[model samples]
Target: MDTKKNIENISLLKEKMSDWRKLSDEELFLAVKEFEKMPRLEVSIYYQDLFNDPKFSKTLLDIYNKHKDNTKLVVLLVSAIGNMIQRYDLPESKEIYEFMLENSDKSKIGPYVAIFLPRLKNFESYDKKWEYFMNIKKMSPKKVAESSFETIMDLYLEKIPEHYKTEAIQYFNKKVEESNNEYGKQYYQDIINKIKS
Candidate 1:
């Protein structure tokens, strides 16, 4: 594949994202998928450029403001922003997190929010992180359980605060016991042992 051309094409696609109303649904969907798969760092740079472009960001925000029914577009935006925050280690992640917190229920964007929370260095103290996890647990039990395991493992390895570390381990153990999958249980047990040491 011609990576340079792909990058340019991706940039071109993003340039038109604000004019999504002008494109057919199929075209918009394909374009969003293409942009989504671009190298994460590249996508972050793309968004940084877009954010810097007053015309583009204003137009994009206007479209989002007007098209409240366009759930797909909302998802794409949330996913893109979340990826940008995670991949770029952007300083603006807190702003994106705040945006997601405010708009999450309106767009059913909780999963993307969940994914973003773990990336924030100081996210451990945020009540929104727990709420995000609870929202996921209510809406997608399996995914919440799985992510809980992953998050706890990460916290243990990262050596988070003692209280939070205890909470993570307890949450993981609870979910592992409740989970039906034998492999999930074994994986949780292994991680629990790893954490203890």
Candidate 2:
């Protein structure tokens, strides 16, 4: 599976990323283009390290924009943002959240949005994140089970009003019906059970 090539790419990616802090905007832009060309293997290996540097937050968003068409890369990038939000004091957190809220669509990374967005501090209630999830659900119920619904249930399960729990249970059940992936269906059912109990 091109392990040697992957190793070489990883080395090159690390080498380029090492100078990110010193690079000017112009140079960083050029470097980010190089990052866009990186395969998922190498990107996955280093994304957290890169993302954890709060200094790189704006650049990370730039890299995200560069890689939007690459869903796996986007997911890794989004997940990195998730990690950054939960663990670090990111100055760009609001901007990053706004960007994701505006540009994100129903794709593999969509659920990560649901998972991470609520975790951003001083924003809206769980209701806003739920609204985002519900909007996406309106478009694709199957996407609900991918990642966000579980996070939604976990985060808002207790915070939400009783009536919303009943509504969420209905959505979870719909997700179970719509998901063809056995694992995803099971996940939805589990959340339904959690809500019901």
Top candidate by lDDT: 2
> For candidate 1, lDDT tens digit of each residue in 85-125?
46644444344555566554443445545555556665667
Q: Lowest lDDT 10-mer window, candidate 1?
A: 50-59
lDDT of 2 by residue, 1-197 (tens): 36566556645654665555666655655654555444323334334454345556665676666556766656656655565555443454666867667545545556656666666664464345555655554433355544555665667666656667777888778879988999989988987887777
Overall local distance difference test of candidate 2:
0.60
TM-score, each model?
0.63, 0.56
Say which candidate scores most in TM-score: 1
For candidate 1, the TM-score is: 0.63
* Model 2: how far residue 29 lies from native, Å: 14
Q: How many residue pairs clash in each candidate?
A: 0, 0
lDDT of each: 0.58, 0.60
